[model samples]
Target: MADLEDPPVFLGFDFSSQQVKVAAIDGRLDVLHQSIVHFDSELPEFRTQGGVHLHGDGLRVTSPVLMWVKALDLLLDKMKTSEFDFSRVRALSGSGQQHGSVYWRRRASETLSQLDPDQSLHQLLQDSFSVSDSPVWMDSSSSQQCQDLEAAAGGAQRLADITGSRAYERFTGNQIAKLRQTRPEDFQDTERISLVSSFAASLFLGDYAAIDYSDGSGMNLLDISSRTWSEICLDAVAPHLGRLLGAPLPSTSVLGPVSSYFVRRYGFSAGCSVVAFTGDNPASLAGMRLQPGDVSVSLGTSDTVFLWPQQLRPALEGHIFCNPVEREEYMALLCFKNGSLTRERIRNQCAGGSWEVFSAALRDTPLGNNGNIGLYFDTMEITPAAVGLHRFDSDDTEVSSFSARVEVRALVEGQFMSRRVHAERLGYSMRTRVLATGGASSNKEILQVLSDVFNAPVFTIDVSSSACLGSAYRAAHGLVSESGVSFFDVVKNAPEPQLVATPHPAAQEVYPPMLRRYTRLEERVLQQRPT
Candidate 1:
């Protein structure tokens, strides 16, 4: 352990939808203190009046870019008040929700300050796209975009063959295409495009345009083997868009010192290095201290399962997202859009009302709901192949009419079974245990259900902010001599987990039939043409 007098403190920022969580950890990966600051643009005063439009994607509202600037400012202000010395915060890094792009025109002396204050630039680009809001990863309106790309690249299988992944509307490539096809003027004006994670880092470092491989891979334009934007992808996309795609940097690269302006504005120490940023999923994988055969299941706004692969293999019928870990090391990933939200909806409408009552009802429902029903949770399942939208057939149409207990059970069971099929398709055997994290994993009933469904031990770590903790681990390992201490050692030395849930035998016996039903439903659903 390092001495407390001046031990290095690695700071990790998790820029989430609900809150921005900032955490600091010492050299030994011990938590120092953490702060969560919340902000909402939905307030009447914060909301824009005439400039916004309710696009098919969602609300296309424009706030002055300064809102983000002020939000970060307030976040730092709160951090300063917490008594944690900003100087001790040596290296800084972050994890953000994936796929949202921040565009900027390249110009010397146009620091983030100038960029932030320039409402005209935002308005100019906004007018160009005519769609004010950037389509976040959660936005699924890119169905048309996905279809076009699939047709152009010779169907889903062919496109997956070239890019090593299927087309998803949330991917940077599709969003760029959407802008180019619909808003040519805006597409031409875009000088550079960046992911949200890299954009936040650029705020501190001033001019760096590098994106971490983890976030870059999510763009569906990045080549997994080369770990760079694919020329083929660029060629396919560049004709429609104008901005130059940036090269991907390793997660550990020192971006540069915090901008002198930011240092003065936020009272940060000089020479504080800002490391490259990654998506929350990759960061969470690091936080969970994942190893080969070790899977990390994050149950956030969405649900994701990540496994450290020995090597990259394009398996799982394109359900797998393969990206680099450090250098040659890679990660295999599966994400579900409707995870906790589905469960919450069930609790509210079907499970006798309230989460407490839902848990009690689930306990009494017995294994497999006595084989009377199954659930089809499809809140988010765009990846592997974009299904466009949910459409329950004649038989399932009644299932969607109203929320019922059996229907909810079917939805939950269906989602878990979908994940199982995905895992199996990726050539992952059932021997691996799952390390579950996020809000959903905290619920005892959900964990038990997951345990029984997957038939694998589900373990929850002691730290709630696993992504931040993992980023801290990466930052600390990057600072000291490589030979002195290893990244694995940092993970190994981290605190013990909070709980472990093993599968119940009765449920385990019942899962096989449920799994078969789920496979049939998924196959039938995917095969049917969208109405």
Candidate 2:
């Protein structure tokens, strides 16, 4: 390990929906310490499952904002136990779960500014939240609100052309509207609204933080082309929405020095700078240091395929968000709700709950699984908005079920095929090298299939959390940082991602027929759904 006198390290935090994660890196771009604190497992008193409180048949998903605050305390404590040096940190940046909103109670900023160094953060600010439970990215409780907002903007396509998305229930615009419609009292009491990213930054800066343009884009309130809140969407969502949100900023912009709380309580230097935090996906993009032709496939709870787009071409199908670090660039994103969890369903039901068994099942099945394709969505899916697990034979006839081995192959093939379709629909070419991240990135069976479906090489980074590493890297590339270089300049010399699996030669012949069949089946399933 390098001596404590080594060049000052930069700090990065990832305040995700489920946990608080941290990573520190030295000036030479080497990792110093990295760790995480899960909200449910570590803080059992909160009684959260996957960091969410679900209701109305899991359509409504919320997480206690205070839990995120406490997670910071626990995460910092863990870092201290590992002999982490807060004094070595010269700059800090972070990532948060995109689109989740935190409603601050009146005088919340004053409460934050006066946080007692003697008391824990969560304990001091228990009453600072106007809405204790925050509506998160998983929530779908605001369908009517979404429709109303869409209609108010003239139509779905018009809204999509303006804000980079048609109205989405999980988006902050609709969630804010839902809160105002259902809980007018709480809405009235709320002094300021913060996206989850800005809320985490507020805790560190001891002040209200400006929302980052990248995270703001996810809210369906940002005019993505201009990187500002759309007045049309704002008027539809609420009164005084613009005043509450304030202005958006570049992700790499430093807000100010670290709060006195950390300086006194954690031995951090008061001079350490705090940079604005952004969404986890954009952080991943920065961490990965994506090239123009590179595609990112994140296999998390929600599977996503993204690419750095040259132009802001918004479509009704997916979304376009401002690039987190490169303020002028935009990113195209296509998310599929049925990702790892759906894979788990097939793994449990068919592979006897063993990934080993699942791998064995994949090995047993042929490349095309004998012309069998499966559409597995354990819940309502976002990509095509299709529900149910439907199976089809090569002839396009619906089948009740397939063999266990076939089921495993079909699940892997189907998920990637959907990603391929949606990415193409959004004007993304699928032939580039795919940088895969998140939990499932390690699965060779999955990567091999991903490579086959996209007809590209798949690679995984060496670091554990791309978001955290990305955030840490951002800390070094920010305005307050010592590096004084572009993010690309800093990361270009970093370790390259490990090549996982490549598409088999036979896959070229196999996937084309299967993709065509999957396309037809997707159309059928979408048509069969009640409109």
Candidate 3:
């Protein structure tokens, strides 16, 4: 056994929608090596008689098993070519996108030796469920199902109060209920269901089912206070479905080992402990070294502004999601469905050809675009939850036409202001600092707007893969059995941040009125919607 002073090297995996990123960290908390493997999106193929079917998105439609074997094959090949030793790897774990479920069956042969690398056991379970693809977190087809579950569990508010989130379409409970209603035969076939994070961990350990608190919290089946599945809520849907759900494991629990088969195939040494998994957001927070008063704004396809909170509270009326960091620690998260993609669209349409040109245009344009007569960037309104709400309102007297520069600034400012309002609602004071990540963090213009809107400093780390690093940190912390170091200690001493942006005092005054106007517009739009 290694001495407590000689902490073992750990590997963390971030299983994202676009790609799989693998990162390794040494005992001193230095990132040793990192690699990213991209997977082509499974395009929907139309079959005249069979209807439309999608394939090749990391799974077989017949069994719905995650085809990480292919992804792992590519990753391991890369590692081998790079001459990264797998033998010294002491622990492994992962951070995965939340809300996805994976199902697996326990092999009859309990011995670790019987778990063959080439076994197609997942295929044999086809008769159990017709799950074709592990529904990615981005799949929102279960909206109606979410509504049903909300009603079943006692209205949206009650469900939010209990689960710490309003039932989302992609959440596990809604997805399970949808499966049960649409394909009763398949639902009955399911022996066990697990989140993608847990499933990835299982792959390394040869265990079929186990869930981590961070990922389980996103399921809409978990009781926030108890940190367990809600029996009353489960019974409201179906007791059988509840039986299929896995128990929630703490973030620090050591699930098992990298199975011998995996060890042999990947060239990793035996006894490499595999820690339980967690959701990507909490992992990002850990990676960024977030503490009280530190806010991280993750701007991916969907944008989420998360901050550590002093107390655990349910999501407000419109906002519904909680941080799964720990039972006592709280995270207030504000999410927007349209984030980077919307910004990209605007860049393509208005910024001519380059981000440099866009930045230059934004810089040349004065604060508030010289009090632009009729300019506002919608970028999808946060309130009223209406799709395509980014369009300009003719009734607003602000602007008649927007220049390319004005349009760019409006989009940047809109997103920042949204974060500001969300943080305020969460009871964060103006003194809080904002730490930014994801695609938007790369844009200096956006960061400036973020700083100005929040009237706080914005810091960006050099590492693009914060979520993966966070996962590795969790794995390392989980491996500590004897007087090990804390996660905060690890991250605090890990690396130095690169860029920091301070708020532009001149623009601070301009943003407050603009934010107020934006809120009014949002309310009007929602009120006009037909109930």
Candidate 4:
């Protein structure tokens, strides 16, 4: 037990797409401190736009491993300048952008096992990685590798049944296969591979950290049911692939105490425990403290919808991962590439770059947007695998365009309706409640459309950084998990999710027919695209 005078604090970190963020929470579960390090602005030497380098081919994307390391150094120094009491930290955990992967050189583990307190991590581990530029979730260059893996596992649906998701180009398994086949010399020189989540854990543990099952399930390499690496999937990727990726542990497992380097340099307590990290989406689910029948929709730069499903429904469209906090359960996710930026584009074009104007347009248009629907993807979308702007009228006929006000309502409605359609395909029902988080969740006008589309009440939480806060909650829960206290019990005292929007009574009448028409229009859009 910690001293009563100074309550123990739990730390949560999020290595997101654009930045690395940290949040500290006291024993009462209230946020005590928060900080961030932006990659593009803070570390311009890496030359990253949106914290990633887009290849000339437009499908390949990567981030500098050293830039991530350097960002940590900057973040901790910022905390130190803020006079944060690192000595009071009891346990720490984090979340990483899903599907990003890191490769270690032959002697990198040896270097990690013996880090020096005097030298910064960036200096000591400058040459430790076999591949300096790690492939991230935005990457989509491994289509051939995806097809090959699916065929090896006896087709798409069969593989989905085993791994909780069908082979996706961004999944780590396909990324690894692409690297091994395309860069054989680099592959031969590599000793181990770590998901971005475990790679960050390794930095704190002073050695390699076991990949948690929740993050491993995103790789298309782990068997979701058995919680172990699949032999067939292993054989399909590379020889002796199981050994490269160490045995995965539960998300709550404590790897060990923080490395002595932190104790000597940053004043972290020697007894501070380092908990296994997980993917950002899973961490958000934990942070929201979702109930059994709740679905979470995160409206960020790239919108994502996830749910704690009663049963696993394997599909090619979305993803299912091992639940971060519950061993016997699973969570499903759907990603939309065009979320905030797409909304911003429409707002600029239709409303002169004012969100208030955008909201007014939504209010002016009637429900269903008078049967106008639009699908806008500024970039390639993952869910339906389509790109570009598409519009349709009430008769299900493709249209050149719509009025600006109609376009605004159509865009918001189309986004939520697609979420409902894809979610239903994965066994989610309309009756489940919604917990909306992320930057766009504060927009009641947008959430009203979401509520109407799903015909469910929309709830909002107060936390701004769900992924980071979720990691802190997990850090606290990990301390009590061995004694059998449920995660819900641990976070029960946290603020209640506030009711933000409820469906209009007439929503039940207007949406059913509109949804049917939208589905047909979506099929037409897919047919027009080049596969």
Candidate 5:
């Protein structure tokens, strides 16, 4: 460690769905301080549930733009009260929940560039947004817009080929299309569109910040291959959209110095560089130090599987984003909407609502659950677009149910099997190492099924705030990225992930047949379901 008298530090911020968090780290990757401002609890004036408002339709979700601003103001104040040395920060980077957007009102730049150190950000910028309630990632009310964009791009596959994804309701471009069609006046008043990632960066830069490519890939308006906004897509969203979005930057770009506002109010160093902020997913990839051949499985409320791919394989399902750490490469992500909750439903029904009993059931069952398979989707699933519980036995014969013990094993196996199939569908073959994160990764039993399904060793790290940590790591890497220092080298000594589970000896023989059967069964279910 360097001299304690104002030793150099790096900062990372995560403007997430529910909270605004910051992590300060030393050069050696040791965390010096962590602080958070939760929007729902601390900023109750917003009256938000889990940081967003759920409309009556249950699909139109939004958060107050000023709420995010106020949370940031509150978070910085908390950090200041703790006597954190902000002046020691060498550089900073951040992330935000992907796909969400912020619409800056006309003349918003004037307010941003002229921020007064004496006034809080929230107080002065109350009217900065064109849309006070910004549509967030949870919003799925843009299906008409999604269909329109897909139709404009030729087809779903054609759109995916260009933008790294089909037109998703939650993507920024579709959201913008909806805004223009539904709220034309607000769309007209919008001067600039910033992905939540870049919006947070703008607060620090005191100017409009360019959306980074990694986060921009989620927008359905960017050409993944060229790393530029597609002119075809721009015309599809709105008129003269290019002027509003400006240019996209690489995730590693060092934008500029911290704003004078921060320097004066928060005592951040005048020389502190603000690196390009990216999406939370990309930041997590950087934080986890995900290598070319490594796969990351986050077992949270919604399970997500992502891996750095050797080649680009854009498909209708899943997504491909420009890699944050490797500019020349890309990352593939497959999200399962029915993850932890679906598993919990099975645990409660079959294991008496006890995780201990759930684990025992899993341990008691053999690999492949003796050729029984199931798909339990408590809600709509993203990958297959299918819901409801389906079960089958060794002969691929449809079965209404199975024993409680079998149901437990089938739930775990089915979830991982679906992940493997979808990941491979995205052109990612099984890699040797699987890095597991999130709340459920702590369960060794669940991880064993994951390991077996992927036929790889599963590893876990002590990551509480990966997005923030990843941004901090990005800040360090950005400081020397121009000199050709790799991200791996910058965080090589931070900490080693612990190997939690390895594939069983019979996994190779057991899973292939079971997976094949599951795939066919899934197809049958999809075919029978009404559109």
Candidate 6:
């Protein structure tokens, strides 16, 4: 038990796209401390760009499993230096970049159950990974595998009916099947497979952690309706997968105490409970403490827009995932690959790398950019299944260039406008609020565009990392939630979500036709298959 002298705190970790971050929130749900381990710059040893290694001509992305382990060690050490009282931390939960996997070798259980406090985690477990490189969500190399799985499950629509998503190349069903086919030897050697979230939780529990329900929904293995593994879909992907995956638990289930590794090395109490971790997007939904109709727009390395829907309505364009906290509830999400990186590109090319200049330039252009709409996909995009940068004038004719200011405006406007179009396609409507989060949400000018395009009030929380904070809140909730308090009631008093930007009433009239323009242009782009 922790010292009753000081109030308890909860720790939340986000194993995100670019970094591993940890934040602590006090009993009242106020953020007390935060720390980060950036892969590219801080941990030069990993040599990762955006926390992953890209390969296979841009179709495959992976991160070293041990690199994440070492990052965990380094982040805790940094937190220790900040004088965060681990002994007072009653519970901890985490969120991981969605869909990336971690492979454990046959000796992994033995390796994980016993760790040397004298040796860093990376040093002791160097060879514990059966696959040195785990396939991540950005990998598109699984098209053939997706096809095979679709065939097994009957077809794409049938699979969607069962699994809550279509046969997307990035979904874990295809990723695992590809592993089974391409690296048969490695697959045979693997003892367990974990989504990156549970993998992080496993390190703390001194055992393999069960996948959380919300994170498992992303794997295309879970029947979101029934809340169990889809036997038909599982058999279609790999052999004996359920054994490797173990049983997925609720996001808020407390597994056990903190590992002795932390109890001995740091001053953490052995009573510190480790709760099941979940997908980053789900955590964001929790962090924002979404109400009935609010849309969550996360602007991270990938821009994801989600809404907590009343019931399951799986569609082909986006995905419907199980809600993290509640049973019999679901979430609808649409991801756009070109997010912050694309913003950085236009900031460099148009405004010489100055966000202030970029904001000024963007503000200079009118809404709808004088009837000019553009698409700039730095890489292949998720929605609309398109790639390449395209610009068009008022007449809808493709143009070579616009003024730098117009380009900046188009990039910001086009991204949010597309989000609106596809969101409606999924049968979602803009309700009272659009809750914007992630790194780019700090930009008022950019958020203004989001507000205008969505034609709803835009809001941002004071906390920068929504996923991590959500996990922290979950940690607090998991520990005392048996008292029968609702999740919203738990977070209601922490801080009011601020109304940051409001849509101009004129924007309602201006954006509808331009959204139509963005749709036509996207159609043209998607029609031309990769040559």
Per-residue CA lDDT of model 5 for 160-225, tens digit only, reads: 999999998999999999999999999999999999999999999999999999999999999999
Model 2 misplaced stretches (Cα beyond 4 Å): 1-5, 55-59, 81-83, 114-116, 300-302, 340-373, 389-410, 438-440, 443-445, 480-484, 505-514
Per-residue lDDT of model 3, residues 1-531, tens digit only: 344465468898987665678999988888899987665532112121121124556221211343443455567668879988787788888887777776443331243235555543333233332454666665567777777778887888788878877887768787777777777776665667777787667667775547776677788888877778888678755666556776777776788778887676666768888888777777777677777777778878878777876545565333323443443455666777778777887788788767887888778876665544222234544433654434343345544447788777766766667666666666566456788878778888778878887788888865577778888887787776335555666556687665578988786688777767767665665666577
Better-scoring candidate (TM-score), 4 or 5: 5
**Residue 484 lDDT, candidate 4, scale 0-100:** 94
Decide which is better by lDDT, 1 or 2.
2
Maximum-lDDT candidate: 5
lDDT of each: 0.64, 0.86, 0.67, 0.91, 0.92, 0.86
Clash statistics: count for each candidate: 6, 0, 5, 0, 0, 0
Runs of candidate 3 exceeding 4 Å displacement: 1-7, 41-66, 77-83, 105-113, 117-132, 263-267, 300-302, 311-313, 316-327, 341-361, 364-384, 387-399, 402-408, 481-484, 506-514
Clashes of 4: 0
Model 5 per-residue lDDT at 457? 96
Best-to-worst ranking by TM-score: 5, 4, 2, 6, 3, 1
C-alpha lDDT of residue 372 in model 5: 89
Minimum summed lDDT over a 10-residue window in model 4 is located at 1-10
Q: If scored against the real structure, what TM-score would every candidate get?
A: 0.79, 0.88, 0.82, 0.92, 0.97, 0.86
For residues 210-232, could you state the per-residue lDDT of candidate 6 as single tens digits? 99889998998898778789999
Candidate 4 C-alpha lDDT tens digits along 280-304: 8899888888766678888989888
lDDT of 3 at 345: 78
RMSD from true fold, candidate 1: 5.7
Worst 10 residues of 5 by lDDT: 1-10
- Could you give the C-alpha RMSD of every candidate to the true structure, in order shown? 5.7, 3.4, 4.9, 2.6, 1.9, 3.5
lDDT per residue (tens digit) for residues 1-531 in model 1? 223477778888876544567888877777888877554543233453331223544623222333344456567767768766777778888877677766555442254444442232223232222223555665556677777777776677666655556787777787777777777776566666777778667776777558887777777677767776666566666663323566778776777787665565555667688888788777877777777776667787777777775545564254334442456666777767777776777677776657777776667666675454443444426443434334242244424343355555555555666677776665456446778787877778777877888888888875478777777777765564235555676567787665578889786679887677656666666666464
Worst 10 residues of 3 by lDDT: 43-52
Per-residue C-alpha lDDT of model 2 across residues 1-531, encoded as one tens digit per residue: 334575888888998878899988887878888888998899899899999999979899999988999899999988878888788788899989988999999998899898899999988999999899999999999999989988988899988988888988899999999999999999999999999989999899999999999889888888887878889899998999998898988887889999999999888888888998999878878888887667888898989888876555677889888887676787888888888898898889998899999998887778888888989988888788889989998788999988888889988988888888777666666376888988899888878888888888999875467789889888888953334566788776678888998888998898888888899899999999997
TM-score of 6: 0.86
